[model samples]
Target chain A: MSDVVIAGVGMHPWGKWGRNFVEYGVAAARAALADAGIAWRDVQLVSGADTMRNGYPGYVSGATFAQALGWTGARVASSYAACASGATALEVARAEILAGRCEVALVVGADTTPKGFLAPNAGDRPDDPDWLRFRLLGATNPTYFALYARRRMALYGATETDFAMVRAKNGRHGLENPNARYRKAFSVDEVLASAMVADPLRLLEICATSDGGAAVVLTSAEWAAKRGTEKPVAVRAISTVTPAFPQTVIEMPNFSTDSGVAVPDAVTPFKSAIAAAAYEEAGIGPEDLSLAEVYDLSSALELDWYEDIGLCKAGEAEQLLHDGDTAIGGRIPVNPSGGLACFGEAVPAQALAQVCEVAWQLRGQAGARQVEGAAVGITANQGLFGHGSAVLLSV
Target chain B: MADGATRERVPAVEGWFSIGDAPALIGNRCTSCGTVFFPKASNFCRNPDCNGEVFADAELSRTGTVWSYTDAQYQPPPPYIPRGDPYQPFAIAAVELEAEQMVVLGQVADGFGIADLHVGSRVELVVETLYSDDERDYLVYRWKPLS
Candidate 1:
């Protein structure tokens, strides 16, 4: 597939702003258009990441954003894959540009989240696994996080301090990020002192829901050249792969894993498969990565990503943390935007926000939290059910 | 006629499990490829390579090893009814069944907490009351650590 240049990227600062989601999306869209030096009317396609919390307009986010930016009669598309919504929308726009269906496409995602643990929609739908887990098992999101954290403790000998180190590192990284929700740099002591929501995982260790928005503009390389764009960040690959059959890991909202007795286990586990697909498509290995933005729903999850994305082997992620390899100035810095640890989670907006941060870093525009000499950057995230997303970007 | 009167024991979600002396989770095995599904897959087999449309009721193993465990320190939101007035927290376990080779999640037996559980610890299935209404007692499967 041909590369599509990221002409511009923008975001509304993530916070608990209790306004309508459309407002944030429009603000982000306008900012992205301005950054691209392209008029809204010049865009040929509008792709939006849908937010479930918001009402009708959120469901039709593509048309909603296009209308908010003033109806330009542009073709529009909306995508929803839970937290991977942003990347799914970006993929749609990239495919449109790559297929020669459009020269320029605008992608946007925004969310107005409710406080506390995200719950299932109001209904007694017993068939829905998302609802069944809550009704029968009372398995909230943190339950799964804690399970993974404890598994790491049991299998890899990871300590609470190691998880705290992840929180502290991201806390420090987000201190200089204006777009981050929680900017205060937390100490390991402070994270350890926080209330335990689940065993081995604290309140500070897990991400909260937040309101935020992110937008990006993609154009054909030829279009970018005509606009006098220099050294634009181009998307090398986007992977929206699903898990192989008989997936053994107990993901969120599922009562049980697929039985591995009948069939051989997948060669790569689901999370590892997500980034492996991207790396294969980009024709680059983990060694080529200058930085990464991974979905750290919990502190320990970030460590898992280090291994999943092949930054290190399983059980060696804690050593990577202790060596400061994942810190901003260290080798293969992960989550330089402070990750979800500092950003909370804006669901649909999050994946695109990762892209926005990578774009800024590649262009040397990230003010203080910039990863120096960033070239090849990757974003990895997975949503509920089987939606896996990863994007590889380079300059 | 009184609050203490015998109440009908019911599965929290019908058809997923059974209530008896040897309470077992009722899963279905694909007649063609031998793939098993919990909460039963009556519609179709999920295996990508096999298109087995028929399944038979298979009783899952009563005992397994704990894959992982955790406790809910706070009360969960609705759809989950609290068992006590002040809301006592409960421990949960994901147990790996040897026969099916899949990990299933459930609440640990009423008294067990993170203190009493560890990964790979042996556990057995037991049916217990999850919550009770005026007329019905909702029974759910829980895991009890084998001493």
Candidate 2:
């Protein structure tokens, strides 16, 4: 497979901006186009990540963004995979470039989220599992995160302090990130003192929903070379895999796990399989990663990713945290862009933002958070239902 | 009989759980593969290996061990009606049934909180009133710790 060069990337800073989602997308798209030194009319394709909250326009995000930027007869496609929407859009653009169908493709994702826990569309539908979870058990998203955190404490002897440390580390890492919404550096005590939203996960440890946008300009290596683009960061692999059934882990928006009685459990659990496919395709191991930008929806989930992405053994993630191996200056920094911990979650825009951060780090443009001499980076994120996404990039 | 005292009781989600003293979750077992699904898979078996289109109602084991547990500290958004005014938070648990080898999530029985539950603790399914309307009392399954 030919490499797709990340010619440029841009973001509309994550926050409760309360503006039209299209505005964020347009701003980010224009910035990315300007950064790439390419005109919007010159682009051959526009791939957009869809958001369900914004009515018809969000559903047709590809056309919405294309129209917002003024139509240039670019072919458009939109993808929705909940939080993994951005990566899904990126995959769509990359596929077009690799297939020789389009030399230049632009990927964008933006969202304007509502306040409080993201609930299912107002309804009395009993068949929708997402609604059933909220109606029957009042299981908010934080409920699931707390369940995982409590289980980690029980299974691996991880403590609340260990989880709080993750928040503190990311807080410091994101302090210098201009695009981050919450740039305040938090102490472990401050995190522990915050209101408990769910047992074992305090208010500060959980990510909030925000309004933001992210976009990337991708071109074939030949196209980049033709433009004399020097030292372009290349996307080596993109993985959007689904869980093999009998999925034992209780994922979001689901009431029960698949029964493992009839079929033997899948060899690699859903989260582990996400990055494994990326590494296999990129022909690189976790040891080859200079940095990573994982979906830290909760502080504890970040620790979970350390093990899932093959950075350490299953039960050894806590020790990795204790040894400062995952901090910005550590052996392999994870979430050097402060992750969702700092950015909150802009849902559709998040996964692309992860790639944007990785691209910046690879290009040695990550400012103070830069991993010195950073070369290879990977991003891992999972969305509601069974959407699994990971992208691998190298200079 | 028309007063609130004698309101008719109905399952919040019909066919999901049984009524009466002994409550067991109603799940569908794939006849071909013996895979059980809660909320019942009627159209097709979810087992990727099995192409079985037939299903039988399976009464899941009433008792199971707690896989994990947590409590909601705040009231969730709409579609979830608060059981009482001022919003009393409730404990929730994911129980692992040995027979099904699958985890099912439900609210901890009323009056039970996180302190009463632990991983590997035994629990049994019970029917409880989730909320009541003017016409009927909606019933749902909950997990009660087995002393």
DockQ: which candidate is best?
2
Tens digits of per-residue lDDT for model 2 on A1-395?
A: 44799998999999998999999999899888887888999899999999999999999999999999999899999999999999999999999988999999999999999998998987588888888898998999999999999999999999999999999999999999999999999999999999998998999999999999999999999999999876688899999999999999888888899999899999999999999999999889999999999999999999999999999999899999999999989999999999899999998999999999999999999999999999999999999999999999999
Across residues A13-123, which tens digit of lDDT does each residue of candidate 1 receive?
999999999999999998898899889999999999999988899999999999989998899999999989999999999999889999999999999999898998887
Stretches of model 1 off by over 4 angstroms after superposition: B1-4
True contacts reproduced, candidate 1: 0.72
lDDT of 2: 0.93
Model 2 chain A weakest lDDT span, ten residues long = A1-10
Deviation (Å) of B105 in candidate 2: 0.5
True contacts kept of each: 0.72, 0.83
TM-score of each: 0.99, 0.99
Worst-scoring 10-residue span by lDDT in model 1 chain A = A1-10
